[model samples]
Target: MQQKISDQLSTTAERPSGRQASSPRAVPVLTLVSHPQPQRIGERLLLETLANTGRTASLSRSAPEFSRPGLPPGQPLADPFLSRTPVQFAPGTRGRLRLLVPKDGTPVRVAEEPARGAREFLPEELIAGVPLVLAERVVLLLHLTRVPEAPVTQELGMVGQSESLRRVREDISRVADLDVPVLIRGETGTGKELVARAIHQQSPRREGPFISINLSAIPRELAASELFGVQRGAYTNAIQDRLGLFRAAQGGTLFLDEVGEAPPEVQVALLRVLETREVYPVGGNTPVPVDVRLLTATDANLEERIQRELFRAPLLHRLAGFEIRMPPLRERREDIGPLFLHFARQELEAIGEAHRLTVTDPRAEPWLPAALAVRLLRYAWPGNVRQLRNITRQLIIGSRGLPHLRIGDRLEQELTVDPQSAGSPHISGFEDTADPDELSPSRRRPADVGEQELLQALRASAWDLKATSERLSISRASVYLLIDKSSLLRTAGNLSPEEITRCFHECQGNLDKMVQRLEVSRRALQRRVRELGLGGP
Candidate 1:
């Protein structure tokens, strides 16, 4: 299993020199477990076909080690290129792979050979104790010449192309050469983890482990042990000594996610870890030395918490060595398309599905109808990248069942509206009683709105989230949530400026007609009109 993984590391012909440092020896081993083959009849034939062809085409080869100039004639390269080891499955060796099905029940292999080019493919079925056959003559590529460039960026699948993202990337590039702690702030689902990964991937420590710890995921009692390591018999339930994230990430990067959720006691330990490159594990007498680049992220406003004395101000100061604030999805409309494509491609590849419509392909652009685009643009994605990924997954799964046109329309409709029942009050708590002029018609704060307009745009676009989002110049997912939070539809006696103006004009300034349309008492309408600067002057 380890050998299979090692071979796959350098299989890709054009990975960047930095990212290609060393592919995980655990990849192939994990892939077999994660993507298991079907267990139906003819599984053996499918496995054989894959073992003969598919895996080879998917492999990436590492680049040759380059020697620096002025080196002695016979000096070796700084980093020696790892040689590929020959892999022999041995006849009748079992394997497993995910079976492709035109429909749900019938399964077929997308590609036949599961391994090739000095690499072995572990079929999922063999891992599951099922017997399988391996191809006798599985020809392999030994060592291929390096290519000009890698086709994909190491950060390819991450979402967002907004100015905010670009700026964040710039910050990361700038910080790569330094050893300062970084604090990433964003709302939930804003891809804080991705930002941390990008920083680590681009830094000099790229070759080392990029360890992450979710402060919220660990229990308060165990937080100390998890972050600072624990000795055997440290306390009750201490079965063995354990190396914590800090030690595991020595000479690399350590990312603390949801740092605000950490308890006060743990915060002190973390501060000490940051100040001094030392850690005192539970039940240990002396502190161990550690060298790690620190990265922290939080959805909550740590500053506000600090002001309220909920969080230690000194700790906050320590973590904010460099801060990068991310804008919500609604704030950056231009990045929607690129983000959509990024997630779409990742989902398809993960599930072993063909490209329904590849991004960057002009032909595929036409397939993503203008209406769909508008829907996507108009809606606001409160859940941000995560919601978008989930929606894209649904679209892929749904496309398999319905007609292409219907599927697109269904997607459009869902994207625009609430995806629940039609006529769900657009937003709640927005009453018609307020004066029309009180709500400025001009775009005072384009980035901040109560959410009604976003939902209306969503419903108007037939729940085609992308199209609705575009029409409103926001993210589709955001529109859906805003409608729920704003309570626009459920609110009673609420009137928009346009609705009041239209009714007043149609009524020819008649109080009765305007009152009926506006759904307010005559006295209330008069007061509103006066407040709106529309009453007799």
Candidate 2:
């Protein structure tokens, strides 16, 4: 009677969330590839939804233990490789196996019990592999066939597989077909120009030239002539007729970077161009027609600048026909590892070396250790993707040809020196160690060096790490490590939740200003805001 009841329950639960069950005679088999661990792999598996509740089952050749926490009762466990072990499944046992396999072109086979027949599973099947329901309970982690790697594109130089990145790509594709202006807002180093280029490349204007100009780089006096072609003798030093960015990008796209930096006069000219699709060159009477699509990028809060009357409100409305915000590196931490690998490969290829270095290789260089990747993911990366790429290049070049390398050891040596010795000898805490003759007679370090002194230096340098490091005569890494250890990077004083909220509001939700005012690290301020339930901008 008990056996019958058990069988009935299994049958009732056999029906999946919505789909019909597979043939009863044909057991569901999942063959997972062995290379690129599942945690790091990005391939989507069939019937993955069914395994949502399934837990990883520990399996090994020795001792073959089956009874464990979360294990389904009365499910037959079998070792596919062990001939003596019989594989049995309860009437409605549903199971899914996650296997790791190699990417090299090779076939994988698993032996079946009783019949003792070996079945081969192809790579394509594993790539779009589906999970099976053997019984109500039964999930296995098996070693099986490998899945082929997903193809990567070098176009736009955007590297990431996270959902955030996918959405950005989708946004770029959707907007590429249109001629409307686009406004891209992102933190520094987030690749706004690359995104603009991608849109241009995908647009109907791909045959036309794409021109980019940094509004901040041009002098306020020459902004108009620089953007719109100038007539000869327009002004002093206007010796030749010059085609400006607007005319140069005539049929294509014009990418204006740091658009927020445009002067008020330049802003008015931009608004006119957008409104009339025409530009007036400096000292030129006729309006030159321009058919260029405009794409603008900025790291600043243009809305705040407008509120302060530093930017024109009308221009903002015209420029932002479509807006896309690129997420910072900290928000898409999962992409860091892959991006590091991508940058490393690019660097190696550019240097005319083999670009086959694998992160999984046990013999990989120390500076490129998997742990460093984890640390990088945790870092705030204030400078974002550009900083990561620069750091990767530095590490690769620094550690090249070294038989062994350990990042932790090097960082410790650089960061663990006596606090006083880390700064200049003229500082109060530091004792003069260098030769007197080597030191300039007129130059002197600060008489007092402490947390207060460091904070002052940081303020004076506008929180520039390199400048702060130079002021203290310490390595940049040491400065970072010291700042982190002493908690000097945190907001200076403890404030009530209300006070913190007030400060955040006062800063117009600008986290950078909040950091500066509070003398805290950006991460610290972000955390405080979260704890106080003060949502960020």
Candidate 3:
């Protein structure tokens, strides 16, 4: 556990500013990975270390008890779905854990494989975290983490029990009072802007207005004036003098979202501002001093953009006085259940259906099944929490007046990865030891796959042609061939001008979104957009 868990957290002895320490000390805990009842998710059981041989898990009050903080302490699993016969977990020396699955009880699956009678987990496997599927009723993750931190709050407004997010919180607390510029980075919809707000709300500037603007959404020509104000009569549309976001956020924070997309000239202006604490209006020569705290966020790979000469290196350095990274939702699957419920509760309340989640009878079947929660947990979540919110909203609306959350027929199929097969083998930071059978879906001959499989593959791959080909274990050419043969599939060649034009505006000239909407090759989509003169390079 010492070596492996240390590897799990950090490489070197020095703890990176926004990362965890290299200490081998970690607490082993069992997280309620998923449940039909969403509130129970993320509850954990903390185990003692080898010094105390860890706490032995056993049944209490006729059911296996898992707590609000973790296993072994507080709450009880009074739910009736669990098998009465207890599954005993005994801890041994040097971080070893022995499990005894009752003969009459449903076989406990460890990392998706059934443990016949008894099983022993080595320290390394426990450090990487093992998923235990109990009677198909609930999922639990047995993993090591640093000591518990404070829970999510109204002020911070982030959710998760993962140590990674804990480190993020620590980063926020450490920097909030320093008055230093902070740069946030993460995948889209991973809540980089939310983190920026958290910083602003917690900082000394909390009383002042926290203004935020998306640099990418503003036109290139107008970006400078938007950020640094416009002098009256500067342009035909400049009917009056305007105070830019810098002055508007005086004595507070101005969060520049999508800072990587800042225009070339705007980048130079930003660098000047960072160095001088001043801004020059669009038509004025004199620089106005600013007293606002600067925070910026981006999901782009600015280093790559710098290589292309699209962004200035000096600006990148200035924006990144201190960097905080928001880990994607997939990296912390345990948070998925909590986050989904958090988002779902709002929609459910809005529709006046809040009581659907409340359970009066323990014997009654849960409206939201554990199996469906597993599917949600196993999803890739490329669009992160924002996409999860959309899916939650979809379930709430699409299933209005239903007995349960009626997962759409299409979404049900798309999320149909086998319970025993998907996401059981690996955690994000651990080494990949994926089963060969995991890739078996691709082993089926491309010709044998039906139109249904093609569409499913396209959806799963986010309409990426190369990824789709790899998913089916076929060549790129075979994917194109399948598209040509399928009557339902559409490519850029066959797309109507009106459709492309509509998609271009709706997606705001984002090619990736166009690729997803049109279900066509990205390169081909770009060519068609250009040929039609829709917009963008």
Candidate 4:
């Protein structure tokens, strides 16, 4: 029985990497066992396909050494319990099979030659086990076990179980300990800053301050003083010595957001500081040393910016010691439901109404209906996670007393409406109500208002929600809901690039003032400016 089993399982194996083949006709064969089934038994099943060719699978409890650069010594790439050895099949061979079995002490073997047929062995026929074959091929030993439980980890304020997010978390873990500059790239509202904070919190600089700034928010003329500090008499308005972001973030991390919007001169200064590990305050000849881990984020294409001479190549190289790209919400739709629930719970708790909403099971009670969830998933989240959170807050607040907000029909109806007629009769029922907060001071609600009129009122009110609400004779919550549902809110208005530029100058490049003058949201204005290639003043 042993000789028959050996002959049946033997293959024309090739020599192992470091050894010579014992027989010229021998082929390499590898054996691997799947993690044990849910039932606990110690029997290893031999996969017929793998036994036909002699090649051993290579499984390790950690990520391969070659894939783990910058990882601390002795640190496993992933959870050891869940890790599996990778198997490499030779050319023309089929991929590996997921074979699993228990320790039933059954003798198993594959036919020596290929045949398109299945052979079954009775339990009593394979009582005696065959000896382990010693071939020139490498044999990787693996003990199959149940799927490992998720390891306890600091989720870093991120809530997602998608593969993309998992990879991001792993990347963060791998590079967190290294004191190197990191560049985060993602579309608008993808939470680049959150990733940066995670890195800082995981690093040695966790105890130090985390200073965050938006480069686009800083005017070109003020970039230098705002970033590297200003002497008491640096400029006409410099009445006091101010420690800028660099010094403020000493011994910690400095996150520069929208860095692609930085002016040419500021880019040069940044490159200098990165190279020297020091900063020269505006109007000061002395160079001040700063120990700050720099992290940068942008939605712009820096490589294109480099081609256009808008950004410095050396600075880009300096900041991008490691690059992490955050996947957009549309790409990770599976996370949307969980994110909505998380935000909804937080909103409910904040309003002291957690008990009013059912939280035990997501599939039932106060949670969004399945149809609404499907609608949400189907919609392209151009605004990403930030937009999702804002929409969730609006939904929760708007659905005050309802036992459950059935959004399927309402959302679908809103989707079919023409965006240009944002103030049409579609949302007619949301007018004056018994709630005092919903009542407008005008008492006479505006009727038949269109998108143009709404835009004009928003502009006249300086983008102030209260003022806009009053002008439209609607409740503040309704105004927000309108903004959320209206595509017109995001579309470019009648203002031309030249007109926006003139208004920007008139407002002295103050973004708030510019938004008010343009009658657009700050995000819309910035996006327009970027689209026009105007480069904000």
Best TM-score goes to which candidate? 3
List residue ranges in candidate 4 displaced over 4 A: 1-152, 356-366, 406-537
Whole-model alpha-carbon lDDT for candidate 2: 0.55
TM-score of each: 0.49, 0.54, 0.71, 0.52
**Shift in Å, residue 366, candidate 2:** 7.6
Clashes of 2: 19
TM-score of predicted structure 3: 0.71
Q: What local lDDT score does residue 498 receive in model 3, on the 0 to 100 scale?
A: 92
* Candidate 3 structure lDDT: 0.70
Model 2 / residue 323 / CA error / Å: 0.8
lDDT of 4 at 356: 46
Deviation of model 2 at 62, angstroms: 13
| CA lDDT, every model vs. true structure | 0.51, 0.55, 0.70, 0.56
lDDT of 1 by residue, 1-537 (tens): 312222322343336654544321212111110001110101011112123343422111121121111222221111112123212222121221222211221121112223212222222112112111112111111111112222233342354433356666767777866788999998777788888888888888989999998899999988888888999998888889898889999999999999999899888988998899899998898899999999999988787788887798889889999998766565444445556656656766776654444323211213333334344544546466677778767766665533231245545644653332211212111122332322335313223655666656645654444565567654333343344344333211234457667777788888766645543334435644655667741
| Tens digit per residue, CA lDDT, model 3, 393-416 | 998898999877779887775454
Q: For candidate 3, list the clashing residue pairs, or say none.
A: 44-70, 44-71, 45-70, 45-71, 48-54
lDDT of 2 by residue, 1-537 (tens): 112212211222246577666322212222211112212211212222222223222222222332211223212223223233223221111121223222221122221111122222221122122222111112222212211122224335587644456567878887998999999998778889989999999899999989998899998888888998799998888899898999999899999999999988889999999999999988899998999999999988898898899999899999999998887674454456567666766777777653345434322223333234334533556567887788777766666665322354544232222222221111111112333322344332322346777788778776666677678764444454455434344322233477779989999888888767776545545666865777875
The deviation in Å at residue 400 for candidate 3 is 2.2
